[model samples]
Structures are given as C-alpha cells and as structure tokens.
Target: MHTIASWRRLLAEFLGTALLVTAVVGSGIMASRLSPNDVGLQLLENSVATAFALSALILTFGPISGAHFNPVVSAADWFLGRRTGTGLPGRDLAGYAAAQTTGAIAGSVLANLMFDLAPVTFASKERSAGNLWLGEIVATAGLLLLIFALGRSGRAAVAPAAVGAYIGAAYWFTSSTSFANPAVTIGRAFTDTFAGIAPASVPGFVIAQLAGLLIGVGLLLAFYPDAGRSADDIVVAHPIDQAAHRP
Candidate 1:
C-alpha cells in the first residue's frame, strides 16, 4: 500500500534518527570519559556536540524524510495532515514512527559497540520524578510549538538551526535534560551512560511527551490555524523546495 517515495522517506527517517542517536549516545560516552571529574563540563561537551550533530543531520536529511526523527513530530504531522489533507498518510506516518524507533535502537546499539560496551544493556539512571515529567512536558511542548510556529510564519527553512538551538538551550534549562523525543528516549534507555534513562522511567517520560504533543497541537491550532494551508510548506517539508518556490 506504500509507494517507492514513501519507502525512501522512511529510509531517510531511519538513517537520520540512527545518526541522531549515535551522536547523542556517543557524545555522552565521550563526555563522561573526557570530563570524569566535572559533571558540568561533561554536560557542556555533550550538549554542544548533540546540538551541532542534530543540525547537520536535519539539514542533510530534511529533503528526503522531512527530518522528523521524532515520533511526536510525525504524529503531529499526521494530525495536521488529517485536517488539511496535505500531511503524510496514516500508513506512512506509522512507517515513520516504526523507522524512527528502529533507527534509534540501532543507533544506541552501535554507539555502545563503538565504545566497547555491552550492546543490549538496560539503562540504570532513574529519571521518573514528578518534576522531571513536568520538564518533559514543557520541553516537548516548546519544541512542537517552535516547529509548527515556524511553519505558520513561513520560516520553516531555518528549522534545522532553530530546532537544534532550542534543544541545546533546553539541555540546560529543563530539569530532565529534555528527552523530548520518544524514540530518542527509548534509545537512551538502552545505554547505561550519562544520557541514559532507566527502562522503568521511559513510560512516564513518553506519556509526558505525548501530553506535551497535545498541548503543542492546541497551541498551533489557536495561533497558526492556517499553517497547513499549503501542504508543501508544512512542518517537515524539504527546505530546498521551500526556497525554490519563494518569489
């Protein structure tokens, strides 16, 4: 029921997400190794690497897969597309989610292997406090609001940089370190490192993120009701295509 184009998009999502997670997990390991005595310095190094890597990955793959790499973002796209008919089809949305999750897991495994660690160990870092859940909700909501707001204001072309910057800022601002993406959260659970989340904690984090997604949708509907008026200019479309069409 899917076309070749859809498959290509899914593949891009897979690769992008995998790379994103690789950057996250790999940087966390490297930071821990490099800054063994200073938690603050380790965080700084990890955040910077992740931000830069994220921007690069988004720019590289946005044309092919919309650079979603996040289940919440894909779900939001599906929800908007349902109303405007310019979004991805339900089947394709599902494919995107599956690919993102698979890629995230693969990325974690690869990162662990690259570091000579066990490939399938569960994370032991407990992060399920109420404050952390609130932070996740806040982080996810802000991310979605920023993304869809750009789509509404016709500035989505800067999403790669803007989103990466927001995440980097959130790393310091949010209490839970802003695991706003569910796929990334799951992937982090596979690694028992500085960035890892315990398996028992992932459900709470994911639920908070979904709740945040709903809040983001509500905000988008209230403020940018016409963002999806043009399907091609919506949240995850190719930036190059957006540039070519400008008058």
Candidate 2:
C-alpha cells in the first residue's frame, strides 16, 4: 500500500496544478503588459515563468504526491503501472483528473482577478489548425517519453529541472505553444488573456493530447519494456500510505 493518504495526494495535485496555472496565466498577463508589442518577448517571459514554476512546484510537492499537475501524466502513470501495481491505482484516476481540472479553472480565475479582469471571462483566442494539433501530439508524446524514460533509468532525481527545460524549449519549438495538458487547456479557456484559449478550441486540443498520450505509451513500451517496474516513481518517487489498507 501507499505511504501517503489519498486525500493528501489529491490535495497536492489540486494545489500544484492551481499554482502552476496561476504562474502560466499570471506570467502571460505580466509579459503582455511588459512587452505590449513584442509577441516574441511575451512568449519568452511566459514560457520561462511557467518552466521555472513547474520545476519548483515539482520539487515542493514531489515527495508528497509525485507532483503530477497534468491529467495526462496521471493517466500515463496509471496505465503504465496497472500491471505492476507500482503507479497510480485505478480508483484514484477520476479523482485526480477532476481535482486537476477544477483546480486549473480556479487558478485561471484567480489570475484574472489578480490582473483586474472579470473573474470568469471566457477566452476568445481561436487555436484551430492541423499544425497545432500535430504540435500537441508531438509535445505531449515527448513529455511522456521523457518522464517515463527518467523513471526507467532511475534519473527521476533530475526530473524537475529536466522536465522544466524540456517544456521551456517546447514552448518555442511546438506550434501549439506546448499546451500538452488537458486540464490546463480547460483552465485556459476561463480567461480571455494572453494565455487563454477559446472554449471552442478546447476539445480539439484535448483530443490531440489524448492521442499523444497513447503514442507516448507505445513509445515508452517499445524503448523501455520494463518501465512498469519503475512506474511508481514517474515524475518523482513518493511512498504510498498503507494505513488505510492496514487493519
């Protein structure tokens, strides 16, 4: 059994994802304000802030919840570890996803409030395009690959920095700006800001991300057949609380 309570883990996921989104949306707002005309500079600032915040959040919460702020990451962990019983259990999947999504939306609202905008303004930025979908697939696939590979190789210690670096780089390289997370996409739709996405564009991005999850699984299996052995350590290693299972 696990060494941490389920509620604690869920809370960590919620707060971590919320804070991460706050960093994303908040930084985007600040970047836009700081460099009103330079889209390039704005992106750079936003990406850098996100990357740093993600890494720090991981470090802060990794030991408690594994710091999986993304639904895809949690799903990947469950899928890859199902057979071995080392990763997230089936029962907790829905809870994790729900918590992450809700927290994400809350974070976006908080960012809007911080910036003196309406609390729940829906985004109007349309991001529909074949290339953007392709970018989501590629970005999500690469992320899963990197995360699982680290677990398999026992390099999870550097996951914070490495994952951050990968995402920072992907923000520049990917066409979709590396929105490889469904919950984050949903949250971004809550605000019409520099980091927001149109609600209409959300479904497509989510579908692409899910597809990327599948592709990532296939790649992980092919390259690291024994990845399941380290499934419990994906992103970071955390002990599961066994008290609930004990008599």
Each candidate structure's TM-score, on Cα atoms with residue i matched to residue i, is: 0.93, 0.97
Q: Which segments of model 1 are wrong by more than 4 Å?
A: 1-4, 234-236, 239-247
lDDT of each: 0.86, 0.94
lDDT string for model 2 (117-204, tens) is 9999999999999999999999999999999999999999999999999999999999999999999999999999999999999999
Task: Please name the candidate that would achieve the greatest lDDT relative to the true structure.
Answer: 2
Query: TM-score of predicted model 1?
Result: 0.93
Clashing pairs in 2: 2-240, 2-241, 2-242, 3-240, 3-241, 4-240, 4-241
Give the CA lDDT, 0 to 100, for residue 3 in model 1: 30
Model 2: how far is 164 from its true place, Å?
0.8
